[model samples]
Target: MRPLLVAALLVLIWTSPVTARATGSVLSGIAVEDVAWDDGTALQIHWRTKLDEDFRVLIVREGTDGLMDTLGLFPANVQWVVDDDVTPAGTYRYRLSVFDSEGILVFTAASHGLASPHANWFHRGRLGEALIILGVFAMILWGTFRRRDIYLRPIGGLSAIEEALGRAVEMGRPVLFSAGWGAQLDKPTTMAAMNIFGWLASRAASYDARLLFPTHDAVLMAAAQESARESARIEGRPDWYRPEDIYYVTGSQFGYAAALDGIMERQKPAVNLWLGTFAAESLILAETGNHIGAVQIAGTDSTIQLAFFLVTCDYTLIGEEVFAASAYLTRDSMVLGGLWAQDWLKIGVAVTVIAGLVGTLLDWDAIGGWLRGI
Candidate 1:
């Protein structure tokens, strides 16, 4: 009977399924890798394990002193972690320690190979953005080489410049142009205003109308003088360019507004052209122009002052219309090509936004993820 029982036990032991024993140090497959396409400031740690909520993973990195330093404590189920506190081109190794539900040390593992981060020339994540930028530049080159008439939407404020000058000529009153209190030659709005000023100066010279430009900035005053002089020279009427007309007023914001109001009231300009940057004084100047019954044409990038210009001025160039004024008026191929590229970019952005919205609605994560450069 003892021999028969021993044989049955042996058969049962051999027939049972072979399973891995839950040894205390069971963590395996630890790996350390470089973070890809970054500035080389990070490393990635990966491992494989079957752990529950009650277990925790404690990661450590080899310090400069050759001792392990704690990286972080993580949940047991996590497969990977990013260590951003690494130096570029520096080799790193990692160790992971597992703790059981009772907070007792259970398992330990170390990465087999060293990993070092290196910077990539281009970011892999922003590939879509890079492609879009390249496409924009390509479109710009195409527009430049083609040199066709790039049609621009006509701006009412821009179109009314000649008419405003005509009214000034008819009324025998000077056409007043101001770049407002915050005017600076370095500013885009001010530069665009100067471009418009050049065109207006040329037209004013042709009509033999007096064009007055009062500036708040001395540097802007200098630029205006040069632009006015060049425009007059181009029109074969350098004598019409008055250096005194583009003079600077007080730098004080309210003081400048007061001086402008005095000029507008005393000179009684039939045409008032307000462009460039403005502050609280925008309403004051526009109101004064409206009170004097001048044909007020205004353009600004300032959102708050836009409402005042819209209400008080006869014609208002909204937002980017001011920037496009030079290209629209001059029709220069380079500028027109830039505008063309800008339009194409805008179209691309709009299409991308709509596509992302549609993709989100349909639960297609790839489209939205790509759009977000993920």
Candidate 2:
């Protein structure tokens, strides 16, 4: 019976697959690789196992001091682990050990070569976006040199600036302007508002209209004063520039709003130009202007305040329209070119999104895959 059993076992071993017969080592294909397109702080450890028995993997790294530090003990089912604790441009060596259910080491392996983390200069995944930006830059340069008129859609809020000033002139009332309490001159929204303010100051001087600007920041008050002075000089009405009129109000948000409301009530300005960043006070100011029967033109980058402005103001410049005001008002070739390039880029993005959706619906994975790769 023992001889027969031995013969059966030998037959089973000989006829079985090579993988089953080659169970001397439970682990195979152990490798270490540097993670790509990263800031050079990670390494990936990869391995494979054929054994189905309950086991765990112990990963260790040899430091520069030649001391082995155990990374962690992971389940056998985990095929890869990312070591983000690695330093940039540092060499590393790793060893992996396979242990059985009883914590007995079964097989051990090491990376074939030394691995070092490196920082890539450019991200390959964003290559498509880079190309699109470069194309837009080239278009801007071409448009700059061509010196052709770039057509821009008129913004009613911006177009009415002159008409608002004209109404102020007709009514013999002041044109009140504010850059809001939420921002300073350093903010882009405030700077954009300053651009519009400069142009409005010049026009106000030309129309001999009273222009009042109040601010919640001292630096912004100084900037507005400079802008008004410069505009007055440009319009050849330096006497019309009133530095006192462009004054600093309190820094408190609600206090500033209340002061503006009082000004609107007492002065009864015929036109109100509210631009820049605003928060809760947007509704307070706009509602006051509406109550006084003023022609209000408002603009802001704050989405939260935009709804209030839209409902209360006569005309509102939303989002990027406020940024485009300087270019639209001045008609500078270079600035207009930037606007054109931005529009074209938006169209391209929209088209790409539609194509990706269509490809997904048709079960054509190539288009979606290419877009994701980019």
Candidate 3:
């Protein structure tokens, strides 16, 4: 009877719950959401740590098999993580396990999720940006119809054009225009150049001063001739238009430069307008014009060539001033509207920057992070 009682007591000791402590819950609120703007291979995991828990949270990713693979380890304070190493279009499961400092499992919580990345037509994050763009476009159209006036700082180069042409007339010498070797009719710089040329030709014809346009491309020559002809007709001096005044030179860069240099030395043009695209040959042409005592006005989009024109030419259009030249001369509504819109945009940017700066100092992370992805 003593042996039977001892055996029964041993069995109770082995099976008793009084010796084992239950594991405390360490994680909660496990949620998974699909990631935006990505192929179907990722999901975002969000979770919360239990109050007063001091443990390492080990996030494990499980597949269809229900077997856990350790994704990452973080402090219990971490609330969110992204799991990117997922198979496309495949279902997945996640388990958030907590471990004590001694590496013993404390508690775990799990959530099941699956995401197959599909391309979305519109990114939810960019919705605000799209609205702002639409708003700006509407503003531009409204201002255009309203004939909103824009204030432009007086550009000395643009203002000096009339004076230069007048000096050419007084000297009784021809006004020379070169669009440089790279001035093709299709390029924006060259197109602007032609527009300015049309204006210049009009003034020249009205003053009865001769004008010449030398080009490296046949197409540009034809374009220049038409521009001159149209300007003459507009000024009621169709007979003043001369095809020989707008002619093609050698397409070879240096060859064209040499020919123009000879013209400068011999013709001694009173006004030299070097506008549009140029190259390394810019310095050479500009130097010759400077030596000939010609009043020079130059504009170009070339970063490297601009330095030469800036110093050598008596007046130079900096940056997009070349593009704005036509608008200033003609006052066309389309260009004026665009310029007004641009000015307003600049103001908006300045205000946004100032506001963002102030907000950042005050701990408003949202405003400052606008357009950060840029």
Candidate 4:
């Protein structure tokens, strides 16, 4: 009976209140969130340490099965470590270990999982974007079918284009067409500039007029060449596409100005059309063209440059009129649709502004407060 009691007492002693202790500081397991899988085949794991827990360092481990079996330790934070580069795109398991003020309390590590690949737009969303594009195109087609005779408000600058080319022809001199620095495919101004170039080139070919083009952008140069060649062909003068005439000037902003200045001083063109985007170079080019007795007609949407052109050139197109040139010149369906859309948008904006002012005067707070409280 005593042997039986001794064995039961030993069992109770072995099972009851088993406590394990360590001398170092105790660390709570790391807390993590907002895991991002980037395109570079990497996973980013972010975590925060326990609040008010004093620790000598932090240890992070990545494991395939999330059991710190194959462990790795992240370097100290004070070393300016970039931890993101080492993390791979797979099931990433992380464990955090630290020493606290009291003792070492190592908690179990938490794991987050994700797969990474190229970002994809949803098929439905892609379809929607396609539909929006098609809708825009359809509206343009509708505008074309229901075409109205748009009496283009006369632009003094546009009106001067022919006269400028004609003046050059009369003097047996070259007509200089600078699409301006603004005539880059990436730039909104270039579209307007190209439209003007098309018109000018056609007129030049018809009159056996010499056309000279200087471009500051490679894209603009290519476009200007195509437009000039096309215009000449349309004018039944396919042989008139002069490669040397439409040449590239330096791409540097002021470098172009200086190159053009030299050309103007040398060729002394009879007519100069500076159309497209211009910057500080606007005045410099126009002034040089002016000094050569060229009939300078400049058009730009730049408000700052308009004043300079007005002072120097024979005629200038200002602000929105410059944008309107494509619609006026091409009479293209899309361009017309854009113009119409803007017209309606402007009307809407005007009505909104007016309504806002009137509502303020009438004390709109009563309506706003009622809505807010409800």
Judged by lDDT relative to the true structure, which candidate is superior, 1 or 4? Answer: 1
Minimal lDDT window, size 10, model 2? 13-22
The list of candidate 4 runs beyond 4 A from truth reads 1-89, 96-108, 112-118, 122-146, 302-304, 332-334, 347-374
Candidate 3 per-residue lDDT over residues 276-358, each given as its tens digit: 99998888888999999998999888878999999999988876888878878777777777677767877998998998889
What is the TM-score (0 to 1) of candidate 4?
A: 0.65
Which lDDT value does model 4 have at 312? 99
For lDDT, the strongest prediction is 2
lDDT of 3 at 102: 60
* Model 3: number of backbone collisions: 3
Which regions of candidate 2 are displaced past 4 Å? 1-23, 51-54, 65-71, 75-78, 100-105, 109-114, 150-153, 181-190, 217-223, 239-242, 247-252, 365-374
Per-residue alpha-carbon lDDT of candidate 2 for residues 1-374, written as tens digits (9 for 90 to 100): 74463344334423553232225767778888888998888899988887654777777787565755567777877888998888885788887766677655566667887888888888877888799778888876775566668778778988888888888999999999998888787798989899989988999999999999988999999999999999999999999998889998899999999999999999999999999999999999999999999999999999999999999999999988988998888788877877777677788779978988898899987867986676
Top-down lDDT ranking? 2, 1, 3, 4
The C-alpha RMSD in Å for every predicted model, in order, reads 11.5, 9.3, 11.8, 12.2
Report the lDDT of model 2 for residue 276. Answer: 92
Count of backbone clashes, every candidate in sequence: 0, 0, 3, 9
